[model samples]
Target: MLTSILLRLVGWLGGGVFDTLIGRVADHLRQKASDDLVRFQTGVQADTQIALAQLNAQIEARKLQAQIMEADRGWWVTSFIRPLIVYPCVLHFSAIVLDSTFMFGWGIAKLPPPYDGYEQAIILSFFIARPFEKVARVFAAGRT
Candidate 1:
């Protein structure tokens, strides 16, 4: 009689209402454990796959970070470094410097100085590293 009364009281309080909820939770836990066990049994391949996926994601994130850093580095290197390195080395290597604006008259007709073969490189890099360019534009427009 006592056992029957206690069971009825427990059922009335929550046992009946929570039975399906408890079962669902247990099912989810079981599925997760089974998946983890399968993954573990796959040995190094599973770990390697996970690590490779993470590294690929990191590569993309690092690329974006690199762009941010490049933008911050600004235009000094682009303007000065490329010309200093390229004009002497690539354009007129071992040749005598006949003029400052044009070296040995071996330059383009209207391309001007430092605009040989790498003008696109100079222009693109110049605009890409443009944190100072922002300041210059603001000052030029007299907005600041």
Candidate 2:
């Protein structure tokens, strides 16, 4: 009888707290979704701009190459080197932004109670390791 009474009290308290938590979580998730949408749109716009710039650079490089050929200079290293440096930097910047988006998404997922063990651990690990991973990848790619 005592155990039954205790269980009933626990259930009552749990229900109220759980409902409150759920409401808050719902609001948080809605806000995060809205934010993610905005971030995604911004990322898309940035990516488009980067692509356009790369295309323009490629065209200019071709033009320079042609001019070099016409002038019999035999050296147009600037055109080749500029794009090689710029494109990767643009790509890496975009990647970092996208990764931040994912990190925010993961963070929202981990915020509610009754935590998912693997999801929590994975999100935490990703947040911790992302910077190191970026640095390692950059260095390994033979870029300074």
Candidate 3:
């Protein structure tokens, strides 16, 4: 009788333990599935946001191009503008060179403040402006 009672007690305890272990496993699986679903939903939302941002940037770029086209004046008026501005600076440089060669040991022709500023500005624009513009466009693209 004692042996039979001991076996019965062990079987009952084992059955309860097995049931509890199964319940714990089911709960863990359910939690893991829930977590995975949330992650998937978040990723989908992020992808949608990125797509929208790209579309908006494209729209803005198109608008900028349209504005530039509208602002363009005729070629006749624009063609002479650069030459008109640059010719005086060239003439001034030539005069300075002639004065220095003809009048050695005398003072060099001093550049007027306005002309000096203009010369520097023109030189800088000629050398570095286009590269700087390209870098700016790259940075702008990254931001978008």
Most accurate candidate by TM-score = 3
Q: Which residue runs does candidate 1 get wrong by more than 4 Å?
A: 1-43, 77-144
RMSD of each: 17.1, 30.7, 10.0
Residues 6-71 of candidate 3: C-alpha lDDT, one tens digit per residue: 757875888888667768999999999999999999999999999999999899877765654445
Judged by lDDT, which candidate is best?
3
How well does each candidate superpose onto the true structure, as a TM-score?
0.25, 0.34, 0.41
Ranking by TM-score: 3, 2, 1
lDDT of each: 0.62, 0.63, 0.73
| Clashes per model (N, Cα, C within 3 A) | 0, 0, 0
> Model 1, 67-98: lDDT tens per residue?
65566556876756655654544344233234
Better of 1 and 3 by TM-score: 3
Which runs in model 2 stand beyond 4 Å of their true positions?
1-21, 73-144
Off by over 4 Å in 3: 1-13, 73-144
User: Model 2: how far is 5 from its true place, Å?
Assistant: 19
**Considering summed lDDT, which 10 consecutive residues are worst modelled in model 2?**
106-115
